[model samples]
Target chain A: MSPTPRRISTSTAVLPADGRRQNLSLVLQTLRRLGPTSRAQLAREVGVTKVTMSDLVAELIGEGRVRDVGTAEQAGPGKPATLVDLDRSGLLTLAVDLSVPARLQAAVVDVTGTVLHREERAAAVDAGQGRGLDPAVVVELVRSVLATAQHPVLGIGIGTPGLVAPDGTVRTAPNLGWTDVALRELVAEATGVPVLVTNDSDAATQAELSTSPASQDMVLVQVGRGVGCGVVSGGRLVRGAHHAAGEIGHVTVGTDGGETCSCGRAGCLETWLSVPRLRAALDAGDDPAAADSVAEVGGHRLAVALAPLVAALDLSEVVLAGPAALLEPVVPVVARSLADRLLPSLDTPLTVRLATSPEDIVLRGAAALVLWDRLGVV
Target chain B: MSPTPRRISTSTAVLPADGRRQNLSLVLQTLRRLGPTSRAQLAREVGVTKVTMSDLVAELIGEGRVRDVGTAEQAGPGKPATLVDLDRSGLLTLAVDLSVPARLQAAVVDVTGTVLHREERAAAVDAGQGRGLDPAVVVELVRSVLATAQHPVLGIGIGTPGLVAPDGTVRTAPNLGWTDVALRELVAEATGVPVLVTNDSDAATQAELSTSPASQDMVLVQVGRGVGCGVVSGGRLVRGAHHAAGEIGHVTVGTDGGETCSCGRAGCLETWLSVPRLRAALDAGDDPAAADSVAEVGGHRLAVALAPLVAALDLSEVVLAGPAALLEPVVPVVARSLADRLLPSLDTPLTVRLATSPEDIVLRGAAALVLWDRLGVV
Candidate 1:
């Protein structure tokens, strides 16, 4: 997660202006993604009128945010039209993934979700716990990464794992031993730049806006040392009143209170499904193939746990996140359970598939969060 | 639930112009809730300026939505100011609760949440199944109740006990043995009014909004013949992506997976906490003080099941649907587990409470749904 910017997304002052400015940015973003395209193509692509497209393009050019690069190859037409696009050097963003355990990971992203420069170093958070992670070291890591950058970093978005209040205070993070920590203030103080803090799960959700096969309504269950889920319901992230809507790891899935969890409770879904537990469970299973694996559990229980949710929601798909070794065990179990419990009258079952976002889903999400923030999508 | 007024709610042609009208309605609702108040009081009460209030009131009076009543004694020594209120005679509303077994509950509400007239009929749903329930009979029962109404009917809102779609379809209701049933269409066809469908639990949530000391963020658990929950996250009803976010009944609280549920699942939270099971447990237990015989045994298992969620969401309050026989036996178990599992770092313990609404919460919620639809709150 890059640090949050100095200014909030969408100035309250600018909000009263006609929404055309927002539409203009959207056009720039779309053109950057589709590459240089003619004005007619942009109008159709952005679902805008030719006049609106030309006006928006003019505004973007006036701001030096877009360019008329060249002409497209003429097909059997009158004459080839010139293609326009977002100026490659328009804006730079800092994508920071605070979920990375060992260090602060930072990357510069352009208008298109393309990485400009990326680096990582030991995090200072460990030092704050007196267990070796230091905030200063983490600041140094980001500073060092910034050293190689040339573009003005418009904003920084950091995706931390825990409950993040909208204002950037980390309300609570068990892993980092942080509670009510004004993290963005400290990050900005350290880096001399704007800072933003968001839940790591939400960052992963923002990552989806850039992935292929855009989801209509999405669920992202991130499996790591601990487990969490990020939800996109009704086309927006589910940020509950307390900003803790995606904390699904602590959902109790066992009535017997089977295993103790770090949350100081037994039978917590996270304790059973976490990487450490799955590995432990695999170690307990005694199968040669499953030995020393996190994915060795019988997927049956997991399927039972999630079935009702799927049935109740009438959701068509879910994206699973985790190393293949960890999630492999539960995939088939989820598949079968989904097939059996669907309304018997329905001919097809819901799809439960692994996230195909490049292996760096969290990293990608962190970057996307920066982009969304810069553009004020929310 | 009164019928949903689709014709008015979906008038895109009235956009921008309606935004002004909508603000006036917002002002009217605020006044209804606060009772008669001066324009100055209205401005402060509705979170608007005096100028905005004046503008809104003028439009509202022009539209006959509000009227000025003579002044009462001023608390302080200012000139007695005229008081304003919703003009009940401006528009009439009808509310219906369709899921109350053997009953068709109806009421009239003005722009305010006040009840004007109340009526009900003995009715049942989906009698075709051995459960002796019939969807058709239930529909007709609602029709008959509306037949005696003196005021113009608003849209109808039906609160069922199971999953509902955004478009008002009853997707799968095991208790009612209904599937892919177009409830909105049926109610519309029968009453000649548009309709909205909500789960009983979600309806309870809406009902909470009208009560004193309203919950900002809480969970409402309806422990009837079946166990279900409505989540108020971000202070809004969490309808998930497909309007089924709170299907905690099938959350698998028991690791044993020994108990079976009507959903054909084993070890669902509903199997143990539902009314029948709670009653059975009380009857079987030797404890003399266990007078609240749940139709079955509902106990610590429910608390344990809720443990993970408490830890996960860090939710501090829970509102249990009340009734001496229904809620008394279940509250303690949930409270103990919630308190015991809370991490020491959290200063407060999660609370278990009762709904302020009546035993016919779902039915009342059904009625409110109609009001919200007609008034365009939903």
Candidate 2:
């Protein structure tokens, strides 16, 4: 009951290599969270000696990753402390979002998580023609974005809709008609920059965590053309043994059959909860009662699917990311269903809500992937 | 995808204090895994300098937790290194399992996970009489066990059937008829030994993990009087926000009406999966078909409840711990159900099996609880 300690593995010791990386990551994350701070203050906050802190800060400055801004005001102090902070705008990351229907979106983001430049292009390949987005087109877009970066570019991060392998291979993405596409290598080869690729839901999860760093255990259900989920447990993404941890779209929710899914399964969560399906129900010409019933049914299916997860993980919240109109009504129903299914606990009441920035969550999450990969800072 | 790195929190830096504890834990674990090891070899295996390893080993020997066990045979070495090993029989742990129906079981366990002495007593309290296991009875058992220890006792660990809080309070144990009982405080005060209390299933999870230490993401479903689960993700026990992460008994499996549960819910997983219900069905004369049907239904219900969890966590295995006769048939049904629900993956195929040591899992897990809490080794 004391927060369960991580199992100590055979190689659990922090060797010198791990120590340096961990310390560097800690310093960067502390600066990102607390803004600017003096070396002594940073050392105290990071639980390191003043000498170690100074050495790490100097290393960061030497690498042009951080800069000493100015001396702090004296408060009956012996020496005016110099404040060190991240060079937020000096480094950039190119992020691409290929999950949007028929559109390719890319952005150049800085270390401060701000988008410096953005562009959109209609995808050349068509899903209707049984062709996925062309790798050449993605490579071309990466080239265009890399050329626009005024500062040093860290890497390219792509959040695509698919079952992405750990090696940045798209195992299969029915929506994009892709199978085993080496997106990372393809883009890296053409653009000559390092690349990181992940499932769109995973990207969105990173985006959500970037905004709410306090959430250690939460699930973000992204309902786009398909319904998928991103799971964060103990402040780390739950990438399952197969890198399919949150592939819940095909999971059959209930016995009562509804529409058939593309996977030839009836009553899949996506069949009822996908944005397209929900929008269709809502756009069914002002039949308020009918639309409400559709939303209610979708909510019930989602709750049935999520109740066990909520119970198993003791999740703090479930964030819905998609069109607000379709998801707003579904939220209360999911909340009610979960309440009825799970044992009532006053101490940790579950929260089910819509995402704050659903529109650009995947895009920003792409940037987050680059930050984590290149800088080891989330 | 490359095994999602653990999020580096602002305070993630390994301080000098953390470094020492982590190194000690690592050395102890390595020795536990590799058996009697020399200081030089241990230093190499633990990624520490020879001097540091010697210091740690000396500290451990001084505490009488480990002993110098002669020397390792030299092969072209400058010196015959002294081998240090855990003093397995020198220290003992008093473990109690209150989860076994109508009985109180306790054991004296050594550091090497051997049960040196075991005892069982018929519980005085009766669930049929609307009285849970009495606190006085448990305290008496602990006192008796304390007197039987042949060596120095490290602590007392209790695996109770209840919703245990982080502070070691039994929030509620319907089976034990306990609520808001400060069991840890009671036992520690009576016997003056440090105490650790956890839910029975959680303790069983620890036991399973002891036998198979490589299982990082797995769920152990202990189906005894009622259904409950212990989830281990990222090599840490998933104690939910309210310490109710694996309370899955009341989760409604399907819409089909079944036997009503004590919670007044129809179609709860417990209604189909509890040992009592399955035994009753299996004992109904030579109706093999009916018994098979019961097992099949229970298995299907379990699959429905677990499908989402498996999908969410990307769990590698689902270990069923219960009566083998009843659970053996449930295994295949669960496998098939999961196969139908989850996306088929060749790389990380899910494994469904029964726990090898089901009868005494809770008792052994109680010992494991002490090992983790007192020694910081698991």
Candidate 3:
């Protein structure tokens, strides 16, 4: 017997009850992307009635999320319309980044994504035993950032290295020696605010997505002490079925075996591409050929790892986030390798470039988590 | 200066104007999945009012897309309710499959996805010169299939081996010796039915998706004379920016180079995994070990090509569509290699299996394209 076709609905059906939230999110997102605009202009831009636009704007203003920023210059207009914009100084998000090995960084970010305050501390780690950062230390760092906030804090967002569940539990961060640490709960309790935790690479991806004009389908590779990636397809972050969508660090790359990884795998991507390994290779000697060879091998491995992704998703760009010196040399190698692997297409050539804001990417991405969670904006 | 966060709205905002089409599609999809359904039950399941559901159902019935079944078995009810379902016999779709080399296959499929009539003809090919099927032959076959239709045909859907543009242009089907051929226009002009052309691998994916209970995130690999993949992420088909998504046959897999492909690339996935090569290796000798080695090497290459995709997309399953003898042996090798490459996780193990309906997959998938395009039900 022929099997019946079980077609699943992929329609964009929205319930009437969710209309308000959807409209509100749309309005906020519009303002965030296009900057300040007149109420009438917003109604036209968002395709809502003038009355509905007025009500949404009023609600945002009353919530201290928006403010009337004087008036706009007339361009052959009847009157100068008062401009409404997000209140950048009224709300704040405390962001923590635990991606750096043996270090902790935090920042107070405003609504406009401006970092008002920043702090860093050396993390105490049992390096010999590979034990990760202490839970208390992470909580203290969040509190320390919270104490420096000058505005009403919306939430605390932490981007840590590990497999983070949607509920903010760190399933495992081998580099940090963490297993099932309730980082979000600890930070929220210690600081008395809502908290969101995500994989640092995903956070960085969000930050890159929010700050750059990249294509909706792109991957951000985070090369630090450990290697990971954040993937975005169709303008949405790809959190895998197991929340391990970008866990590429441990994927064995090539047939030829190389350095061993902490995961007990030889020829893993991390062994070839991690910042520590690249830096070690560079520091080995003044022999540029040796350093170049390391970069070449790492780049080739990275290309091997990324080729399938590029082919499968038809990715337009690959953004590498790390020290430019280490990654820049690797870019050409990756580009060449990808060209060799994928179909030769004159149009839609894949580009590999460094992240523009590499230094503060994770911190800003952590803030994006709070922004998206609390306000449904970004 | 820090850049402002440009948050694109990913909210499911439906314009009031689009409400009607969305609801109608929802109802049709519901019927297609659950068979016959009562009006009241459909309203409840779709979270819409009975009046709205009735109006949508009436429109579908008037269009001859749906029909009312006599009655449903009463379950703790005061009276039996009339059931509504898709009119399987009233409408038919003409599907064409030009994927098999030197063969042209066509089928007339009804709403229930049953093949009502089928026909096949040998394609005229300049084998020595590598010229593919003549366009006149394809058009003639479509005419023959349309003439046999017992009911009104919805459209013509084609699954061909090529890079198809959204406009139904066969941008390049090297197997068919077609370049920038306006296939949809040519077929529609001759048959007077709207035509949709898509890559055969993508078509097979649609057929598999519509027939099986596979995960939303999955990839279907088609192995015949060539290799290609169809990727589905988050329940939606991934059409790349250039409409070249899932064009993975040419991607080089391993470091060691092997036989050269027609694309002039050595060690392409097609060079290692195509059916002809596997068959040639199996026929090269009576030794089982040699055939096993061919399968092993092909399996390893496939694994290398897929590991990054698995890690990047966090796919839940990989479906192989081809002859059982050739593909079944390659499954375990791919699974074991993926396990070696990816992190070990007990929660979401990726499954690799053979497609259940390999013989009629492309033809059925072509019908699915018509279904999704015309009714927006899939």
Candidate 4:
């Protein structure tokens, strides 16, 4: 069965069609998080106004989406300032992460982005990643989890690997060996709940970004058995023309005519960076010095392959998603390479970070994606 | 002193407090473009109603901003269609390109985006990296052009290469050696006209995407001595958090130590791609056999840089910007690299196209940026 999920606050995602509802939701969510925020501060953060915030807060309280948390710390107060925040237990959401390579995770996500329940198990889809995995078994696994789920689930968010069209089609999923799958329909029809399907890496990136300081403009690189990236610009996920962006694994990095890549090419960066490929290269003992070469010259070749991206985009930070054991050994080489190549023009130093994602993060991300949609993009 | 500048279209950079006028303006502009067409087409394209389009068209014609262009082709012999388009000759806009690296350029743009009079001069801003080119000289140049112009200039648009904050302040310009310069004020003061400022590469990208067959998910890479890129995802520019997106020149390309970069670092792709740097590499007389190195490897490197961007975002194309003499040499390399790196899953091949840009694309880009604003972003 799947694990539990995390609490979600929606601000950067699309809002409800009616702007008044969007504004009202924003006020309630912000107040919930801030534990009793003033109307001015709420307006300032939400890019609205004190008058609007006040009106919205009143409406939300009337709707029970929010409540007065307490009185504010006043500066020689003429009146005891009223503090407001979301009713933490008022609404809870269920998030599902079928995106994991081999495991199913589920979580109970509250409106404040708190994770209430968590689970982990052998995911069915992962068996297909080149090792006789079946799609039907995966569907069954998701079913069992939802059947056992606690709390009144508002929605189900599924973050999986593949090409997800804006209209909710899984055009291609190599991991699952699937194509043009009617993902939303099947899941929505089965679960009898509103479902949202998004690219797995995109969801992880969203999770990382939603909780990070630099959510506005950042690129999140996921280095696992393969490498991919997600970009957040202007407080929104960068969904490309055909959903094919952030596929950095195919970048050619090797200077020599080297090994063949999974994409059927020779000497690609993926040949050097991905876990299985790197492990295999290490095992070959063929490039005898390849082991020592790990930190010496080609730990991942990621820095070199990624320098142009950072330079061209003027992005200040790069976040990573992967196992600590695999990612740790390579971070330094990449970091050193990056430090050497930054543009002289940028005043701020670029940073490379690791995503502190828990097992529940993917599921949380999925649920958060929907929640953000509810609150309206910040 | 200046040529009569053509108008890209009607637009306002400013987001108004009241949105009613914004919606009205959008309707007016749509009618102006599609011609005195039926209410149906405008309704679908503008996301308004047939009645709404009619009302807007009536208001625009009443204000003399629009006129009947001609009659539309009869569809199934329903009604003799009325064709309508903008009264193109009436609207006037000033387009300025302060970000022009080598020679300073300015012009008076009209509603037709025609340059009535043009003036040119030379100025270097960023110690020749083209980063910190002053926006003021462009303002004065606009003034000189406007002094003799006949049309009623409605608004001014200024495009430059740097990080432009939404408020019109250039936070940082590495090439132009500028930081925190308020460009709009200088332009307004010099030209005595309202102005809008934007990133130069972004403006160029906008011009490229606003036209025919443009993909929503595309990368516009402006190749010069210093390479810059613009990302369009879901039809919106991905301006990073600090608004610094599309600065690809600084990304690292060398897996190991190589040469120091212009950014006071080492092994940056910019060192290999920039005009002087590449020319120097080519002129070193290293080997005649490596004559095609730039052509073969440069494009490949670009493709690699784009791999992650494309795969992650599911983007469809990459746009190369530069005079053919410069960009043509790298096409094959890019194609080869991309071919090798593509994931086996994609059915449709990604496209890398040389920008079909105008002679003075930066100027047109500036004007086009204004046009988008005039049309109403939402």
Candidate 5:
């Protein structure tokens, strides 16, 4: 199914001002997708009147967020209408990814999710030191990224590895040594820019959802430093009561309670399925044979952890986000494991694929968060 | 958390007609919960002008779905305004529960989900004979219940155990020996009344959600003749792509691949958690020690199956639907098992409780389905 924007999809009554904003949002989103397009075509696609479309486009142009570029090629129409497109060069977004291992990654991305510039800085926290990324270091990184942006910065979107409240407070990030850090407020106050703080898994899931419009319901498992998952059900992000809905890493999969985890628990899914563990297990074995065996075991374990979720949510697809060498070997194992467990009534096969949004999935996801917040596009 | 209705909550733009219906739905839902209320109070609660509220109430009264009673007692000031309420005596709904074992249970429920009348018949199906409930038998059961209704029949809502499509087609109900059954069409045609067919678990979940608005995200595991679950995520039923989202019965939980299930799966959750198997296990035990031991193990297994789901969806509650003797002993066991597996960030403890709906959850759920479909109340 084509991705349906939440605003117009469900016909509900709205005040005129709210309705106008919704129409403008629809117009902006369509322009992002279709590039330069005639007002008439844009209006038709957004199911709005041409007059309303013109007014919205005019407003955007007046705000210097959109530009009219020449005229469209018409076959035998009355006139060649002028094409309107987003002014990509007019605005920039400072997107920061604090989920990277041992590093804080930042990027200046445009409204189109195109990374305009990028930078990376070594984070201050060390794993054995029992510390996490310092809030000051993260702020410094954001400042560095903002300084490099040539265009006007719209806002800052930070994708962190932690339980993030909707208001952008970091409840806890074990690896980052952070707890109750009002990251959004801190960043916003320091830089005088609007800010959005979200879990890395959720940001990645939003980006994945935006690209794969066909599959509205999916679970994206990030097997990086930890084994967290982001769930998109019924075309919306399933943020739980405490904003930890998709934090699946700590859920125990091993019945034996094998290894103690950072959370003071045994047999956490992360202890077995995280990238570091998988790599270590492979390294402990003899070259190819050991890696293959480790992959199979890890895949089977992942399937065990995900089967209940797939069955419970009736998810149509599962995507793995990690190095291909690690993820590819696990795909078939997970697929076979799920096939054996799922009900026959679920006739439609659950497709397991890798994330398709290039190497900077988390970075792009951070940018997408800003897009969603500003435009209501997602 | 209070249950937030979808409409107007997000402040998104809506078309006039849709906005009107949404407002109307809000008004009706409020009346359903609050009983008779003055229009000014309702207008204030719904955030609409008194003129709009009066217009909406007038339209509903014209449709014979609402009525105005005499004025309320005089307050300290001006005259009391007339009160409006749902026309409970104006229409009735026939709710059928075909999920019961060898029994087709039904009721004549009012708008408030009050069972005015009820009837049950021996469903024409024998598992030993490999025969299932005939569609004709279900239709006849609905007609029999409709005959007893004193008010105008609003429609028929059938809760069946199977994969139901949005249009009410039963893709497959293995226990019912039904495949590709146009159940809604069959019943609708027979009685000349509108019909809705849904998975019994989903219906039960809806009813559970309707009554318990505080906990919007929950899982209701119906351990009756088979093991099935209904998921309520983001305050709405999580109906899967094939309408089998919560069909966890066939999802293999045990690694042993123990007994072969009716779905041709081994070590399925149903093979271990189904009511029949649990009862048989208790029956085979010579004493309470053995029975309690079996219950403890079963509860652990159920917890293992649910831990991943609880983590993945951040579900706050799990409600078990089964005989108290069977479910009560399992609750503490399940809780202990989950406590060992779940992450600490999920600070809000997961509560495992028994179904509070008396004896006929599916029947009430069937009524809820109609209420939700017609008034957008749920």
Candidate 6:
């Protein structure tokens, strides 16, 4: 079902009518954060009366969202209280990503962001470029994953490389030759499941933001088929007015002529940092020094483009979400470039790190969208 | 007093315990947004019961935060309801700025963001480097402003440059030569008034975001003594992890060493776009063509740094907040530079506009900080 997308409020202030919903959300989030815990502990943590917490727990249990997982060992209390936690196996989320180069990946995940079953297939390549991939292929992948899901599926999420509308339409994806594709509606109609569509980088950002010890203000740059970015500040993804906020791949990096971009622009960051472009540049010459130099140049260019963002947003961390082989060398160069330009008085030094298996990050983020939208898990 | 800095929650969800408070905040915000209105209309607009709204109104009136402003004219056959609105004259806010070059400016403003009085004094400059201004002078300015306030002061807001801690400490302001100064505590001690402190650019961004039809995702670039940016996304200011978000001055724009910056870096955006630098470049050559060319180059350099941010954050607007003489010439140049690089498929055009009287914008924003913190007005 194509549920209407609701705009996320920037203000963190709670409302009167949302009191019960907020409390329920807090309980669920706490259960996810703290793992198995007692109702008394939850009541204390959530600032609710024990009786009220019991009621909330009962409602969650009835909905199959939480389960009573035995009792805590008594240390000093007369009676040990029953420990409850999220029912990880109780629900499933289907996530798919079309942003991966030459392949379409899908996964069945649980409410806790654990991938239960994963699948992928190579798309028929056209013209040596990532193009002419059929939208029906994505729809089929969602259906195939749904068939294997043993648990009740909460929703289906699709992350693609493009500007996505709130209503889940792909406004444009030059690499995939997709424009105004109603991929969300097609998948939902074929599988009869709730579907969410977002730009792949935004999905990856959401996944990163949901991780433990997550910084509320961070930037996740996914350097794969495209060199896009996702920004999270004040705990919300910055979906631009045109829903093209993370299209850093097309940002101009040089005035001199370079390789042409998919968006018809020359000298774009994508031209310099895209996996295919980097690979081609590496393949052009066999000398190790040349390769190292190329990697350094790529990293330096990326840093130059990103340093302004780091400063403008006061970002806590910059994550490179891509293959280690391609992004690892670039990390040191990028770090050095950033240090060279960034103000030296940085007390909490801006961290630059390589994300673990960012290929699946967008898929997980797609699942997170379902969790965030359907269950308010975030 | 320096209230402990409260961390902003990324989640927009409301809480159960905050029901009454949220309702009160909504009423106050609605009154401010919609102007004077009757309790029945407010109840209908806020989706609260008339009885509950009446109670809220009574509480607000009793607290002198709202006032009954006569009765609405009855169009239908019913008793005229009493109109109520925010008591604009009930509270005053004192705002100060250390971000201004060679001066400490302060203002006494009403709750409605109306400036009632203003004063400025040149700070003792050191070696014409825009440094050596003592934090004690800022404290004295706040005291002086507080002395002249005609109304009951809600709080004092100070907007300075460089990194600011949540506890109102100026971590480092190379321009002002401030380091770990407890300006908030000092002002509070000197005047016995509640105080809030923040980066001046952040304050300006807040003021801009509070304007009519404000875009939630916007950037305000203050091009003054030092070039810094203030970012607002999802309706909240993005104060980074180190409280140094929006420090864009040192972001390197070129390889050719121009002027060494106070931060000991060369080829910074500040070197290219700061008011003093541009003025010097203009005064160095009297040719109008050369001045236009210089302005264009400065704008292009700024756009190169900012385009990535625009693409990364999906910002809707980029505001140049500075003196018209310096910023006006750069506006069209910045717009052209951005237009040349930004993807052509953008549905919502990114706007570049000059801010109206940016010097006062920080002062207003400081007042806004007090409003946001003390009254939850934002």
Comparing 1 and 6 on TM-score, the stronger one: 6
lDDT tens digits, residues B1-378, model 2? 334444333345755455566688777777888889999999998888899899988888888888999977886749988899888866678899998757788889886667888877887566568877778888888788778888878888899887998889999888877779999888878987888999999999999988788778889999999999999887778887777778899888875567878888777888889898789889986988888898888898899889888987888989999899999989999999888877776476899999967867888888887887877767
lDDT of 5 by residue, B341-371 (tens): 8865447788888887737788889888887
| Per-model TM values vs. the true structure | 0.82, 0.92, 0.91, 0.82, 0.93, 0.92
Q: In terms of DockQ, which candidate is stronger, 2 or 4?
A: 2
- Candidate 6 regions exceeding 4 Å error are A1-17, A75-78, A125-131, A255-257, A281-286, B1-17, B73-81, B127-131, B255-257, B282-286, B357-359
- How would you class the docking of model 4? acceptable
* Clash totals, every prediction: 60, 3, 1, 111, 4, 3
Native-to-model Cα distance after best TM-score fit, residue B299 in candidate 2, in Å: 0.9
Please give the lDDT score at residue A316 for candidate 5: 91
* Local accuracy of candidate 1 as per-residue lDDT tens digits, B107-172: 654444556666766655553554644557757766766675666655566777667877778887
Best by DockQ: 2
Calculate DockQ per candidate and list them. 0.19, 0.47, 0.37, 0.29, 0.42, 0.37
Task: Order the candidate numbers by DockQ, best to worst.
Answer: 2, 5, 6, 3, 4, 1
- For A160-238, candidate 1 gives per-residue lDDT tens digits of 8878876787887766656678877777787776677788877877676467435545667777777777766445566
Better of 5 and 6 by DockQ: 5
lDDT of 6 by residue, B1-378 (tens): 012112223243344445566567778878888899999989988777799899989998998999989988887988888899889877678888777646678999876677899888887655346467776777777778778877778888988887888888888777776678887788888888788988899999888876643787788998887788898776667887777788888888744456776667887888788787678777887787777877888898899888888888788888888888867889999999998877754676888998855557888889988887776676
* lDDT agreement of model 3 with the native: 0.83
Cα lDDT of model 4 by residue, A1-378, tens digit: 011111112111111233455456556545545566776778787676678678878887786667777778787847757777776565566676766557766666776567777665674443344543354554565576666665556666778776777656778777766677777777677778677788777888778766764456667777666777787765667766556667666666645556787667776666766666556656878774675475334454777666655655556777777766656656677777677655544456777767766445677678777766544322
How much DockQ does model 1 earn? 0.19
Q: Summing lDDT over every window of 10 consecutive residues in candidate 6 chain B, give the lowest-scoring window.
A: B1-10
Interface C-alpha root-mean-square deviation, candidates in order: 12.1, 3.6, 7.4, 14.2, 5.7, 10.2
In angstroms, the error of model 2 at B110 is 2.2
